[model samples]
Target: MDRIDGGGTMSLHFGVFEVYGPQVGGTLSWPHPLSDSIDFADSQHWVDIAQIMDRTGYDFLFFADGFGYPILGDDIALGAVERGINFSGYDPAGLVPILMRETTGLGFVITANTGVDHPVQLARRFSTLDAISNGRFGWNVVTGSSQNAVAELFGHTEMVPHDVRYAIAAEYVELAKKYWEESWSDDALVADPVRGIYADRTGITRVTYDGEHYRSDGYFGAPPTRQRTPVIFQAGTSPAGRAFAATHAECVFVQATVPAHTARNVAHIREVAAEQGREDPRIMSGLTVVVAETSQEAHRLAAEFDAMQTDDVVATLYAGNTGIDLLALDPERTLHQVLEAGGPVGQMGTSNIERFLGSNGAPAPTVREIIDDLKGKGTRGFRIVGDPHKVADGIEALAAETGLDGFLIEPVFGTRDIAAFGELVLPILRERGRLADRVDGETLRERMRR
Candidate 1:
């Protein structure tokens, strides 16, 4: 059971889907008068945002990794730049420490593309954050999806096979786990001033692991963190991705536009975990809430958000994510047919079309269909635009339908949007005994698992 709050019980948790660099996609294609006021580039802005989440009693804050700007027909896609798609931003590794210092109870989850990052270096960086957060750190483990990221990071032009990439990721995680868990004993650190000792030297020992993709020999340079190994989080829902999550991840990101279908996915993963003799991982879906006192006003806000996603912004973002540039493809080729056969598959084949097929369990969507879907979109996920009651109903419905543990809110207006949810929907959830209203002293892992 989760920790009970002052007058309510914790039935669900909430986190932000993304709190990325200042350059994150926004009111680029259209007039985003309010968003212009937000300075994503300023480190203080994030600190302020972290404080907001902390005050709101949010479970965690997460940031995404970007290789570079989006690429379409040109080496550097100018259209994307004008549309304000992908661009360079602050490093999460760097940002997490800053946020850790600024806020408490708000866990920080940052991405580490296991396909490209060295296990030892990853362990050190994550361990440092975990220590700083006092074990309030979690990792969003990803196999690189962007081809640009792959080429620049690994010096590889052609992509690796999808399953093989996961296999590599599998080992990458294993080796990192070795370092975080086996390197230092709980009593290794002996900061005894009178004894003239800072550590029990004998308690520290080297941990060696040799896998198909990585090998390491040495004790983890960092001390044992709050969570011995930070809680593992994964995002891919492909077969290989699902398998890996079942075996290792404590939490997963599911693309669940269809709640009934997502229920099946959740059940399947839990079954897999049971088979592995591990507890089920918490399942969190992305949520967007546009709430106002009046339903009409909420709808207006939704429309305003919808206007900003231009054609270039939509295509570039989709292409960057799935490695399938619908604009670059032969218009005559049916996207569904090609995707089924691994059409122009990248390293991990984590394309939108593949995810669409798996989540929908319907015919592969056509190229025209995908374009139609992306036109003038503000954001993705299951968005609820209505008065406070309706918004709360939608959240409860989705959780009941899919057995979801929580949602990661992705807002267009950043902190203001999150504030609206905290103000409008949170009270209702609290009234219904579904929200955690405070963070006392539970570890991040404890909070998520409960």
Candidate 2:
């Protein structure tokens, strides 16, 4: 609560990864001891939580998205239905206006797949939000991981190749950027009642973009906002995805592997940005923590929650992703060969490949390894379990170890999870000078960009 002015060893950014609607993933279908009793179905629930986060000095509240439920075994929706998996709640963009109206400081970052959106519409939507929110909006660009969702949900019978999807994302983002950055001159809007004209029509210009994936030319329809382009956030870990982020992203979300792995990722991203004549993007790692009054209590809480990874859960989610049933793979074959024999290279999933799921250069994992990884929060990101002090120590050490920008907490409960963290660990962080000084009127972009 006290000011640190121009001093602090380092100021780590903070954010929470939670749903705008009902919950999904490991956050749902599990017992929540610290969960808030707020009604998730009601709009007020989101607004109140947003306000709480803003008051606590969070940088942003991020919502990840997917079009469909995770597929387990044969039935695509059964496992999700039985496990109470809610893929999406409210539309993040639509709900942004509501949250913005209620809270003054928190930034909102929403994920949108490049494979599905029209460049122009996506551009206008974000540009409009930025202007209206006073530059408090951000866009998290993703080349969707699920082939089935893209095909079935979006009505595309043929799934786009993973690498090719990145190519398309490149064009999609380029076109969107042109609209956000170049389509209209800053002085284009002139409201002059004295001349009896809201003129400056001469300054307005059109954007024309043509690429292998898309073509568009039009006068931009969105008015300029605080940040002409809302802060560009990207969360791709693949080589192509990393290259794309280096070229365009302002905030890069990376899965937390080991400290060395994350440190390497941060260095590579900065190097890529430098090559593109840009500074290093603020790099954030996903973190899921289980903490209570004591280290023993925290571990007990974590152990109490069942993983709920039945065969049905694994098969449904895996099949929906790569369209290859793990149960069907030959037991004697190595995973590398099994995948090759399963189907085309492009169709084999790129998201859960060896680098992300298993350790580096380690031979492909056995089917047992696959199940273990998918069960609960396996190899997902940075995970810590302990009391407030221990949790704070882990976070501080990791940030110091990896030179990370900050972390997006994968909320373990409802709003209470975040509230508890703010009350518990935030003071320790403040005392240690890890969090940035709270600026009264800092714009979201200014807060993160610095």
Candidate 3:
């Protein structure tokens, strides 16, 4: 295939609430005094949401999972639960089959970290899900971020450095691909009635990989799914992460806070992929949408969301993800102080910090600045609050300017927000020829290719 011209337009592939689960609502946590009022423990509601996403022409629903909770400010996670903030939930993968069963045609993407699961076990589990979902499965490869997660589950004191983790991930993926793509030939499965032969023995081969981080022996157990290897999705923007995605990822998730930054990252990935002899990978950025009948209503909704956000909860969540103890800093102190202090707790790396801070400005925004921005306006990745046409226009403008593949649509209110996007913004996108008509029976790869 020829390179995608910088000028050529492409149809956007939409993803629903699949990326972040109900946990997002907890970002501000439940505003209601009663925790019972908002219940995410129930899986049935998510199943119903899955059906809705599939019916609405969403290409896929990607699930983002983390192994540990935010452990900041002496067990502030408790506050997360009390505030009904995004604290408690089952594993995102556990919810995948439930959602898959409710929708046919909607792709299912699950996050599995190399730091947590063994290579053979992880590969087998993904293979099983691929079989169960009839090949509509993708893995968002993640090397976990939380130290609590690593220490609690794996008995490690903390996660390895970012570069080392990616090194491990690179080997893990290479071994997995060998098992998924190279182990079994396209003609591996041949059921012969006369001979009662299920699979041609000659067609299957063993995978023997001895790498620095992982090793696996024997052929892949399950037969190849529709897409032999599930679509590879990755979310790393660091140099090492970009290198890994360039070689293996079919889809790349970016967390830039601005359109220009997102565009730069997308271009970098494409350039790296070209150097790696791979076609351009689809790039999706994390986006939060606030939509209403009018722009004014949208602003009101955003304000309501901000009103719901508590600084304590935001600080806790931030510290949890960044390994920074925000409580140590005076709330009044600017972010520049923290940068100057250069404490190990919050200073993970430049790229990691930038994910929270928009790249357009200097020493990165302070916690106060970030919170204020979220309150007044939204950050990065497309924040448009308007009627259907207005939202569509924002999406188009972002696409045209940044050259993004699509968005991982985050809903303000669990499933309802995504449902609204499908009902309202989708039609306008279709009319503008930015989205493709529903294509029946297409594999995830096929749909994404379109």
Per-prediction backbone clash count? 1, 6, 10
* Alpha-carbon shift of residue 210 in model 3 (angstroms): 0.7
lDDT for predicted candidate 2 compared with the true structure: 0.73
TM-score of 1: 0.91
Stretches of candidate 3 exceeding 4 Å from the true structure: 1-8, 18-22, 29-37, 73-76, 84-86, 331-342, 345-352, 355-367, 374-380
Q: Which ten contiguous residues of candidate 2 have the minimum total lDDT?
A: 22-31
List per-candidate RMSD values in Å: 2.9, 3.3, 3.3
TM-scores for candidates 1 onward, in order: 0.91, 0.90, 0.89
Ranking by TM-score: 1, 2, 3
Q: Which stretches of candidate 1 lie above 4 Å from their native place?
A: 1-10, 23-31, 36-38, 152-154, 329-333, 337-342, 346-351, 355-362, 376-379
Write one digit per residue (lDDT tens) for candidate 1, span 6-64: 55433788888663554343224224665532376678878877898888778898776
Candidate 3 similarity to native, TM-score: 0.89
- RMSD, candidate 2, Å: 3.3
lDDT of 2 at 433: 74
How well is each residue in 1-450 modelled by candidate 3, as lDDT tens digits?
A: 422333455688788634333346226523423212245667777777778888777888877676666666446465545653445556776778777777888898888887566677777788878777877888989876555544656677655777788888888888888877888889989988898989988999988988888877787877878887888999877777777888889999876567887788889889989988887888888667777677797776777766766666655555556656555666566555566776553324335555554444655556666655544222124567777788888888888888888888866666667777888888777776677666677778777777
Error of 1 at 124 (Å): 1.4
